[model samples]
Structure formats: structure tokens, C-alpha cells
Target chain A: MAVTAEEILATYEELSEIEAQFDDVETDIIRHQYNLSKDLYVKREKIVSKIEHFWPLVFEQAPMDIDEFIQPSDSQIILGALKSIDVKRFEIDTPVEGGDPRSVSIRFEFNENEYFENKVLEKKFWWRHGKDGFVGYVSEPVDIKWKAGKDLTNGLLSLAKAAWEEEQTASKKEGKEKKELTPKQKELKEKLDAEAATGAESFFCFFGFIGERVSAEENIEALKKEAEDRKKRQAGEKVEDDDEEMKEDEDDEDWEDEEDLDIFPQGDTIAMAIADDLWPNALKYFTQAQESDDLSDDEDDEDEEGDEEEEDGDKPSKKHKACAHGCKH
Target chain B: MAVTAEEILATYEELSEIEAQFDDVETDIIRHQYNLSKDLYVKREKIVSKIEHFWPLVFEQAPMDIDEFIQPSDSQIILGALKSIDVKRFEIDTPVEGGDPRSVSIRFEFNENEYFENKVLEKKFWWRHGKDGFVGYVSEPVDIKWKAGKDLTNGLLSLAKAAWEEEQTASKKEGKEKKELTPKQKELKEKLDAEAATGAESFFCFFGFIGERVSAEENIEALKKEAEDRKKRQAGEKVEDDDEEMKEDEDDEDWEDEEDLDIFPQGDTIAMAIADDLWPNALKYFTQAQESDDLSDDEDDEDEEGDEEEEDGDKPSKKHKACAHGCKH
Candidate 1:
């Protein structure tokens, strides 16, 4: 299920194997690009709020005796420096030439396509460090950068792990035919695995958030409305293409055997049957959802700007709508 | 921030630690319980849907063998299960009876004090494995059984390795701060650990419907609300009691401060300041809002029954309403 912490780590491990596709990375160094899409600003406040609300539960502050490095892993999709890195226990401060140095520099390399493209975050280290017990500057905010491909791999992995946890808790009735993965499922998972191998953001959210969680969100009707238009994903009970082909061949035969002589109308019968066909593929609605989220990723940036903005520095719109169509980063 | 999967895992770990303190041996076992929660179900569906949607992706099958665990660990999570039992594939339907099969049991063991106990779950030969399929109905449904002071060592630890994934993920983020458990959280965690050790269930929802994927008939919001409340499980945060000596010291400071603010207006100012102190204890109001979500949980259930007797589950007046003194559960 990859729901546990181990699976998340494993997912990241998978993402690490596919780092060549998403972001820019060079050798072992992460090019730490502030890849905030234009719309990310709109959701910045909410993202930050959600993160701040939960982060304290994970990282507690301790007095640090040495300088430390803290940054989101390549698999992480952090919004701001606060959420992206942990500076609570770090004695990381430096004297600014003329201003407070809450800034860090980054260099990006995208699969030998682009290498060491440098970027710096300014006024980032603006928090009082309870650990170091000093109000100073972070001369060098540790640069934890990654190639885009790796970012996607890791993000996808983290999402996959999240999905796994969701599944474990769902409580599938035991002995209820633990369904095997179809070839399409295998490929989706394989692609997920590939993304994980490269340390990039995972598209598995389509699986996690959409596949499992959406049913509970009360948006079924709205989502169902999009089902007809959303067919990028597949139907259920399909193990492989051969099975699907065989099933298609037998569909007509099965159709003829079931009350064909003026007893019941074929339209209603077909509708019910289509609904049955849609049950397994119901989650595929998330694929289009992902695309829609992608589209809104760009649209939301404009809206996110309406809510709040990262006061530190404006990042180029790299904000991928977690769910939207026309989503180009 | 326990915002990421790692953070969430750490939170659960901390909760487990808090659950520990009830009874020494009982709580210890809970620390070993397995918690797959949600990922597997979503993945299984996601993979299947992807397979169905993109039947083209499935070029060929693995040549269906009843015994073969094809792609045993395609996403690595399945591999984790295989690794735990020390086999890539093992037959469950071979039908062994009365071996005390362990399913994914999430137990929370408690002492007479009524505080939280331990929670244990794992993957092993649970009672859910029927001869044919789900309807075979060989055993009783999973029950949250707890014996007085029972040692849950083996049961809790059965799937400890799988839970380790969750634990490690949480530890990764939390280790950077507060230095893991403060010996107190660990004490609390044992209560949950004990449940894992002692109690066993028939069938494991092993990563079932942790979250709602999608529902054509039901509202997504309703499903989401269900998932959220069910997941809530009402695990309380561990609170550290003040030392008696420390309490005395605080009393002494109060008296000293009174002496310092001898003037009337100055004393009033001091009193206001004292009242306004939002530092340590004051922060609790804003931190992790202990809002009652039980109300939201039942909102859907009532709607479903349309005023049926199922509303008995929504007994907020009896349990969670605080009885006007804020003593709600």
C-alpha cells in the first residue's frame, strides 16, 4: 500500500530512479530552484497555513551546537522556505553585507539539458531561532535543490505513500476478492515507480486523492458530471488489453442473451451496464482531474495572488495545481 | 511539521508512545502493532483503473499462474508484505484452521484508568481468508477484543515491520526536533503498542478505504467527512504534567511579582499582563484546535437514514456535549 513511512521512503527511492524528467539537477547537488508558478501565490496563504498547522507536530526545537542543513527532499512539494526547510534547531546565521541575510543560493541542472542555473532566495531566514538563542541571519540557507524530473518523482512518491496510508485505513472486507492489478494499473504503477526512481513529484495523487478520497468528499455528482468528458482512464474488471478485447468481443453476445425481445428497452439496460462498466474505472476520473488541476494550477496562481503572496520574493509560477486541467508549469 | 507522510507517521508514533504509559507490558506490545491504514486499497484500485483505462498499456500478461505473485513488489509495498512473511508469494486459500490467524487488527488497549491504551495492527494470516471468496464466511467478523492485562507482544509485533515504515517516515521529520520522544511521548505510545500486541482481528482492511476515492451515488463531501472522522479515532495528545516543585516555584514567582507591583495602577497593569500572558499556556488556544468534529461526522449518517434509529450513533448530548461544563469526549 506504500501507506506506511517505509513505503513513502521506498516511494522516494523509486522517485530517485527517474530524476531525469521533471526538474533540473546536477550530479549530487540539488539546484534548489524556487519554482513557484504564477498562481502558487494565490494558494500561498492556505498552503502555508495548512503546513504551519501541522508542521510543529513533526519538528520540535532543540538547542543546536552545530550548524545544520535543512531543506525539503527532492520528493517533497513544499510551498515556502518555512515549510520547505527546518531551521528550528539550526545555528545557521550569517552577517549580511548591508541587510539581514535570510537568503540562500541555488543551482539547477536538468538531466544534462541545463546545468547549474543559479537562483537565490532573499529575506528568507527572517525567523527568531529559539534553538541558537540568537536573532541573526542565515548566511547560507542550505540549498536542497533537485532536477525537475526528480522533484516529480519524489512528489509522486510522497503522494503515493499518502495514498497507501489512506488504503490501509479503508478496511476492505477480508476475503473479498483482493483484486489483482490490471495491465493498465501495472503500467500506471510502473510509471509511478519510474517517477519514484528519479526522486521527482509523483502523479500518484491521481490515485490517492482522486481514487480513494474523492468518493468521501461529497463531490461525486460534480465529478460524475465530468465522467463522460473524462475518459483518459480505463474501466474496471479489466486485467489487461487482451482481457478487454476478449470482453469487447463477448459484449455483443452477452448483450443478445439478456432480454433482447421488447421486454426492456436497450437504452436503459445499456446505461445500467455502462454504469457497471464505469464502477472500476470510476477513479480514472482523477486523470482528467489531474489535468484539470494542472490547468487550474495556472489559473489559481492569479487567484492565489488575491489571497496572499510570499512576502520574501516572487517565484516564477511553478505551482502545479494539485488538481486542475490545462496545468502547464 | 507532520504535514508530509513522514510528519503524519511521526504524529501517530508519538500518539502510540503516549498510549504506552498505562501498563508496562501491555503498552510495550502495542508499540509493535502494524498500521497499513490506506495506501494499498487506493493503489490496488489505481493500478487496476489505469490498466483498464489504458488497456493499450498492458501489452501482455504474466501468463496467469494461480500460484505466481506477478510483479510481487511492483510498487514495493507488496514486496514489503512478502518480505515480512519471508516469501515473495504464499498461498492463503490453502485453508489452515484455528492457528490463531492475525489480521490487520487496530487495537487500543487501556488500563483501568480509562486513558488511551495501545493500538496494534498488522499483516499475517488473519481470520478473513475464506476458502473461496469473501462470502465463504468462515470466521467471526473482526472485533476489538481486549483482555485484562494481556500481553500483546507477538500480535502487536506481527506486523511491526510494516508499521516501521510509518514509524520511520514520521521519525525522519520528527528526529530533527524535540529529539524524538521526551520519554513522556514514549510512555504514551505504549498504550497503543499494547493493543497491537494483544488483540487480533479476523480480516484486515489492510489499507482499505482509508479515504474516499470516488462515489457516483454518494456525495464526496459525505464520504470525505466519514473518512476524516473515522480516521480521527479520537487519539488525544499527551500532556506533560507540571512537576510539584516547579508548581511551587511558579507560586513563589507569583508572590514575588505581587510584591514588585506594589502600586495600585502598576499592580493593575501587572494583573492585566498576567491575565494576558499568551506564551506557554496561552498558546494552547490557537494550537491544534481541539474542536469537536464528532458533530460533522454524524451529519451524513443521519441524512442517510432520514431519521432512522441510526441517529443513536450521534449521541453528542450524552458523550461529547461537555454537559455544559465542557467535559465532552
Candidate 2:
């Protein structure tokens, strides 16, 4: 039996309602993520400030090298029970009075369970110019324990997946009933897929924050290698045909990364995007990326343009580093 | 024992955390509200279009006046099961070809549960400029049912009140322990109180919607009456002292409405405001409003300016009307 266009519209409406139901859950999870992120920031800043202050006072009476004095082992008593760590290094961009520019390394330890799933026990240790002996600070805005990013992400993904499945089932039923779908129905189906895809991607992108940029960079590196192989093949080098097939697989994965990066270049929480009624806006982005894929002949130039932007102070993202005093790897 | 500034800051942070936990529930409630508002808009449009089409062809031979044909009883049969009603009147702003510009009256009905809480069974009826009879149309974007605004509000208010109580108890305990409070502690206490007040106000403002605006208008009217009495007293006119005392009670109530209207002048979903990190922004608005109130000796001129803005079509809100067909008052 052929379904009427009106029926298609109804199906579209039903699909939207399903998606909208997830809006609440998605928003909740995002809020949780935001709170955690904010806590991390405050904790980091407080510890960093303390380390800065602790350095000058301790060295006032004893003339010791700032770099050597701050070691992980030296601060082992101060740091107490160790937790997960994020290490960071900073350089003095310009030396005061033309003195040689110096650098420092810092280590941040969060309570294993707390850092991973709860908001408790965050410690920061700092070592200047070397990774060793450390001094620590305890930060504020603390809590006993709360749900971690992973837990929130899992919850978000569950709701999002359910929404996607509901929409997909409705869309599939419409397609099976009607041998040929109306243009509007076809459009609706495409939009439902986009919404679902973006919904899932949002969770993945948000929770996997630092990982996403790293993956995109990795994808580009793989693409560059693949391009080199193609050039070698064209130059009549004896490259195995099996190598070409592997390259093709890598190409598909690269496209996924590219689409992910393009969809959320700035890496904003997907929950916020959905809350702002931005599905249509996100669809527009997907459309642009799809068009760009069709015009892949210009890929090299596009990569070159991205490189230029990076050179113009467009860093991939701000990385949160764990400062550990004195234990050089 | 006096509470130190550090202790005060800790209290403030705790209060914020309490409110932040409500963010998820509030967002859920707001999303529900958005869905209801969207449904209302869609249903109204569908019914109006149906009535417009139904009128012309059915009475072409008799050629009766449109207003005369549309009656409440006629639409009553077509609309059948009445649930709840929202009435509206539409006027042709411009007369076509210099003829008399006509108007129409429309009545919307939803299932009683549907209207307030459920999102089911919405039907619309309308009578032309000449209401002799009425015709009906079932609207689009239909759903079986949904959670009502009242339930959402009640749930929100419950959580908000809990958060408020917890913070209040904490603050009081600290105050009791420390007989004297530092200036910073005083400021923190004030801010926590403000957050609690705003949180409660947000839920009330959202649920009250149009009623809030009406209340604000009513407050202004009362304020004007109180001012008139004050002027009479200054002029040595015979004004009853008891009347002046009664007016003071009304004056305080009016001030509350005035503050509410000022704080959320747009009547936006408070949940969204918080999610967007707009609490600080809203606080800034409150401060500015307080300053304005202090400089409000020239309030009459401000009212006149507001009237001019309204005349210039600067009314910030869209107004809905009550439509009456064959029913007498």
C-alpha cells in the first residue's frame, strides 16, 4: 500500500517528537559535563597559583636551583597518595632583563576514583625546567564524590541511541510500505539520519574532547602518507595492489574524521547545539562537508589552507597538563 | 567567633553548587514548555487555514454574511468534545480593493487533560466576520499526550525549594556559630539569598506567562493610584489616613511585580538562561534596574516614554485574544 504525503508528514512529525524527547536527557548530561569541566579549571588554577607562590618563599634562605629543588620524590611526602596525573610544561617566552629564558614542568594528580568519576582529591605538583622533586597544592570547589564524565557520556549515549533507533525504525517502515517515497519523505528520512548521526557524534565529540583533535591530526597524517603512495604508484614505482586496497580503507576512516572535525570545528557541547535548535544549522554543515568530498580534487589545497590557519595562531586546542615534580620519563 | 572571608567564599560556592544541580531538571521542564508552545502555534495555524477554505464554497449559492454563518453552536457540533479553550480574533489589516476590512473569530479546544497537561486531541473552529455558523478543522503536528506545564513547574519548584533550604540551613548554621560576620561574608549571604529568590521567581514567571504580564500591568495601575493619594496629601486635600495605610500594602506588592518584570523582561525560560551561564548577566540587569529605581523620581516621564514605545509598536510581547461566537457573556 502506498502511503499518502500527509502520512509521510505525520511520520516526519512522529520522528521529530522522538528526537525531542531526548532533548531533556541530553541537556542534563551536558550540564553535568559542564560542571565537571568548570571544577577542573578552578582546581587547576588554584594549584598553579600555589606552586608559583611556594617556589619563591622556600628558596629565600637556601640558594638552590629552582629546577633541581622541585622534584617528584622531594614532594612525595607533600603529595601523599598518588592519583592520575596530567603533566604540562611551560616556557618563559621572553627573559626578564635579557636573562636566559627558563621553562617549568607541572604535574596534577586527581584521586583515582575521584578524577575518573568523582570530584574529590585533586593535587598539583610543580618542578621547574625538569620533571622531578615536587611541591603540591590542594584546590577548592571540591565535592565528596559525583558522577564522572564517562558515566554522563554513557547516559547520554543511551538516550541518544534510543532516539536514533526509534527514528530509524519509523523511517524504514515508511520506506518499506511505499515502494517509492515522496520527495518530502525522502528529505525527512535524510534529516532524521543527520539528526541521529549528529546526536551520537555530539556525545562522542564532547566526552572524547582531547582525543578528537588528536584523531583528526592522526587522520591527516595518514592521508598524507596515502597521497605519497598514490604519487609513487603514478610514478611507475612497483607498489603492491594490496597496498592500494589498504589505502582505500584508510581513506574511508579519514573521511569520517574529516566530517567529525568539520561538524564541530570549535568542539562545543552537542547538547548546547541541540538546545539552541541548531539541528538545521548542523545539517547545513554536513551538507557543506559532503559537497567538499565530492570536490575532493581540491583536498590538497584545503589541507594547505588549514596549515596556514594553524600558523596564524590557531592551535588545535588548549591542552590541560598534569604537573608532576621531578620524575623525568 | 566571626566567619572569615574564606569561609564566606566557601559558603557561596556551596550555594552555587546546590543551584547548579537543579540545572538538569530545569532544562527538562523548559524543553517540555517549548514543545507545548510549538504545538499551540502549529494547531492554531492549521485550524485557521481550514476554516478559511470551508467557508467560501459551502454557502456560495445562499451568499450569507460570513459573520452570521459562524455560530458557537454550529462549531460546537463540528468541534464536538470540548476540553479547554483558547479564543482568538483575526482582523484583515488592509481592506482589499477599498472594500470593508473583515474579521473572524476563532475558538481552539483541546482535551481537558490535553490542554493543561496532555498534548492530545486539539481541534479548532472559526466564524467569519458575519458569524451565522461555525466550521472546524483538526490541526497538524498532533500527539497523543504530553506532560503538562503545571507538572513541570511543580517538579522544578520542588527541587529549587530543596536547594534553597539546604543552602539557607548551611548559611544559618555558619551565622549562628560565628556571631559576627565579615563584610565579605555579608556579601556572600546576600548573593545566596538573591540566587534562591531568583530561582523561585524563574519557575513562577515561566508558569504564570501572560498572567505575570497582566499582574505587572495591574501593579502599575495600583502604583499610579497610590501616587495620586500622596499628591492629594501634599496638596492638603481631604485624604483618609486609613486609605493611605492600605495603599502602602499595595505599593509593596507592586514593587515585587515591578522587579520580576524588570529581571526577566522577555519572560524567557529561566532554565535556558542558566544553561547559557546568564546568571551573572541577569545579576548585572538586576543591579542596573536597582539603579534605575533609585533615579525613578521622574517615573511619570518614564511611563510616558514607555507609552510612546508601545504606540510605535515596541510592545515586547505578543498578545492572544479571547474569541466569542454565539455565546453571550
Candidate 3:
């Protein structure tokens, strides 16, 4: 049977759900790959479209939306990788636009102005605060300034809103299915819950040696500033200028988008980037001079400058004579 | 009890004696970690360093030297990872630097041209002879190119030399102390060796698929150019020409090290880029305000805004909402 574009669209949504929220990492990934490969070659071209249009982008950041809170994916805990790159983001030069769920970036103002620098780190929503008398972690924050701009990543928001709607609708439709409990049991449950919720100590403290957590916001700000300055100086060669141009171009693109844009093909940036990174070493084989000719001449080619290495039982060469005035070669 | 660097180094040299090669996926990175952790911070720090420095500088458009070969690590594959970054180069960079004898980076290449562009598709090194088939892999070029820049990294070549000596000496000592084998057994061993050598086609091909296998150099280069251009275009603003005065003014700070310009940091550029990529989400967390706080201020603070999330239940109005409609209270 012909797999329609509609089925691919449905599959995309289903696969995204399985990938993002489905709790089992391996299972979700397997399901995602299976779906991807099933129509792998067939709808391959459309994935790029989906990614390009994944705007009014949805970002995963901050405390769960109330619905997500009540029934969070168990897998969400493991995915709390504190550090993750939206690998796709590196590949696309799309302007930073606004209006998406979890699109916040953090800006920490140091309590001590010594750490202050005009810097911004654009990223997803996150939180960190000190709790205990002993300082440890002053959590990093996620800023949401992007939304104030042209508000383009709304597609991501609508997706979140739709999920929210489903959560709300699900809550409404399938509720009242709870069993009636005795007063004593309810009392015990509430007490347990209260104790859990009201636990005095906070875990977010930036713990380490003493004074490490003190004015951690300042320290973090200082580090962030340092990091930010370092980047601007490095990419400063062209980034800021490019950033403005990119944003303007995006605004122009948005003018043409007229609110609705297709997303399937664009989502395949992940696929495209993968293809790009893997083909090089593969190419060496195709590009090599016939080994019968080349490999024969180069069997012991490594014995010259300074790097001598060992392979299994064979010695490639003592070619790198710099390792202590070597003459044994 | 003393753990001086020299003693620790000597102990590490001895440890490689029992370290037989494995042809399976790593069930334990901890083991490699434990073995290579003589310079724990050094090793871990080097992973990022290897990625930042040697990758772009040496391997990006370099030719294969054919003399370098890496013993596979526990997970000897980074087959389709050319999309964002290639962990495949792990072996060459690690060995080239000789940071850790136990651990090796998976082999990866930039297609001599293609780097991170496609979503990983096929990563196998093959040659259509138009006559004879299947040219073997020669990672020597990557190693040679990688080594060419070793002086830029600290003591990495020295460490590699140390490892080579340790391995060579250990192998020699073992050979000297070995027991004699019977003629039939010797013949069997010889046969096995030939078979193992003969059996390497699949192994190398597998390596081609897993590690060295990659896309065309042109494809990756084009993709990178496209990605970089797109990135610039997405983020590009019209560059205002810098006034020579302002450029000179910024240059006025003239640090003493600037005089010693030859030793300026190379890895710092990619390092900053990496940190740039990592900083966004961290920034967001620091910026978002607590939605629960606002809800509590509006009504009773004690209810905790329906923390249970009422899974499969009615949507409670009091439920906590985070980052909604521009982080509205």
C-alpha cells in the first residue's frame, strides 16, 4: 500500500512523542529508528522540510508545565542531562526568533558587580537556587527573552498547547476512576506527602569546599561572563555581525511564511547532519590510489620525524627519531 | 603509598601488560577510566581537548597517511555520527597524543572534505576498482596530520612515546620469558594467524562502517560550508566596517603574552564554540521565575498547586504552570 504524506505526518508526530516523552530510552529510540527506517528512503526528502519549519520552536526547559508535572515521563529524569546540545541547532543558521515553549535563556546578574559583564547566553529554561546553611549549588537559570521578539516559534508552542490540551482532556475524561479511601488511609497519605514536600533541606545548593557556594550567583556570573567574553573574542571575528544579518533575514523569511509553514522536511536536519559527518572516512577508500601500488610503497612510512608507535605485535617503525636520539631503525 | 607522578606513571606502564585487546562493545567504560585515570583530569580534559584542537586543525581536510592504525576501544563504532561531531576520531587523537594507553577514541574522518552535514547515513570505506576490489584502510594520514600539530599540545607526543616504549619493552620482555611450543601447536598457531589476517576484511570493513567509514570529503565540506554559511546567514547581520581606531583601541590592552604570539591557544576557538553551545539552557534556568510562587500569592500557599498532576484526572485550575504565554504570573 502507498504510504501517504498524511501517514508520514502522523508518523512524525507519533515518533516525536515516542522520542521526546516516551519513558524508555532504548525502546523509544528503537521505535523511532524503526519508524524512520520503515519509510526511510520513501519519505527521506520530506524530513528536511519538517526541521526547517519547526519554528515558533518548542524548547524543553524549566519546571514541568502543571500537566507535565502531574504525569511526567519517568524517562525525563534520565534525560536531565544537565548538558545536552540541540545538535541540529549547530547545523542550521536560522535566526534566533521568538514565541516557543521552553525557549527561555538565562541571564544571571552577579550580586557582586565585579563579575558583571554585558553578556547573554541563549538557551532553554532551567533553575538553581541555594537552600541549606551550607552553600553548594546555585543552580543555573534559563532565560526567556527570545519570546519578546517577533514570536515565530509558535508552532512548538501550539504543539505543547495541544499536548496540554490532551493532558487536560485526558484528565477530564478519564477522571473519577479513583477508589474511595478510608479517612485514616487518606490522613496517612497526606502526612507522607506533606513531609515529603516540606523537607527542610534543599538539594540545589552548589556544594563543594566552603565559600564555594557563597555568592554563587556572582561566581557563576563571573564564569559565565568569562566564558561569554572568550566566545565573542573568538567568534568575534564575524559572529555578532552575522547574528544581526541572520535575524533580519529570518524576519524577511517570516514575512513570506505567513504564519503556516510545513515542518516535515526541516525536521530532518538531524538526518542531514548525520550524513555529512559520516561520509569522510568512507570517502578515503574511494579516493585512495590502488593499494597494491600505494600500500606497498608505504608499509613502513611512519619512521621519520618524531612519532613512533606500536601496533599489536608489529612495530610500524622507530621513524620518529626524536624520542632520545634513536639510531635503531 | 606515595603517588608521585613518576611512580604513578611507572605503575601505569606495568598495567598494560595484562590489557588484552577486545573486539566487543565496551560493557565498562569504568575499566578504561580506571586504567587511564593515572591522569584522570588529564584524560577527561583531553577528550574535549582532542575534539576541539586536533579535529579541525589536522583531520578536517587532511589526507590519510596509511601508517597509523588504532586498536579499537570497547565501543569501536561511531559509524553514523558525522552529523554533529565525530567521536570516531577518538582513537587517532588519543594515541597520537598518547594521553591514555587503555582508552582509544573511535576512528573518524572528515571525508577529506565532508564533516558534519548529513544526518548519518552510510559510513563505509569502499573502492570500486573498475578492476580489483577492496583497498584496505590506512589511518596513518590522520595520525601523521594529527601528529604534525602535536607540538601545539603539551607533552602529548612524549606520553605517546612513553606508551610505545612501555609496550615495546613489555612485549620484548614477555617474548624473552616465553615457553616453547610443540611443532603441531606452532603450525596450528601459524594457521590461526594467517586466518586472522585473512579474516580482517570484515574487520576493516566493519571498522569502515563503525569508525573510519564516512561520507565524501566534498559532501562534508559542502555541508559544513552550507551549515556555517547558513549559520552565519541565520545569525548574520550586515557587518559595519570596524574603524581602525576602535580596532586599535581594543588592541590597546596589549597583554604581555600577546608579544609571544606564536604560542597563542588554538583549541580555545572550538572550546568557546562548544561552551557557546552548552551555555544556552544553563542560561534559561537562571532566568525563569517560579510560576508556583505566583499562584500561591494569588490564593492559599499551602495547597502546593496540585503537585500530584492528577494523572488521568480532572485538570485543576490551581495546578502549577511554568513558562506559559511569556512566563505570565
Quote each prediction's TM-score: 0.16, 0.18, 0.17
- Ten contiguous residues minimizing lDDT sum, candidate 2 chain A: A320-329
Which of 1 and 3 is the better model by TM-score?
A: 3
Q: Which candidate is the best by lDDT?
A: 2
Q: Would you list the C-alpha lDDT of every candidate in the order shown?
A: 0.25, 0.29, 0.25
Cα RMSD over interface residues, candidate 1: 30.8
Q: Compose the digit string of candidate 1's lDDT tens values, residues B46-114.
A: 323322111111111111111122222221222122111111101222323322112122221122322
Ten-residue stretch with the least lDDT total in model 3 chain B = B127-136
Which parts of model 2 have CA positions greater than 4 angstroms off? A1-251, A255-267, A270-329, B1-329
Per-residue accuracy of model 3 over A1-329 as CA lDDT, tens digit each: 36576543343233222222211232233233333333322232232122221110111211122113212321232123122112222111232222111112222211111211223322222111111111112112222122333222222322322332343354345443432333332343344345445433111110100111223343344335433533543443321213334334434322122111111111122122222221111111111212222334665864533132122101111111111111112
Which candidate ranks first by DockQ, i.e. highest? 3
Q: Report interface Cα RMSD per prediction.
A: 30.8, 26.4, 24.7
Of candidate 1 chain A, the 10-residue stretch with the lowest lDDT total is A60-69
Q: What tens-digit string does per-residue lDDT give for candidate 3 at B284-317?
A: 2111222333444554533543433212112111
List the candidate 1 regions with Cα displacement exceeding 4 Å: A1-147, A152-184, A191-208, A212-329, B1-329
Q: Which scores higher on TM-score, 1 or 2?
A: 2
Candidate 1: docking tier: incorrect
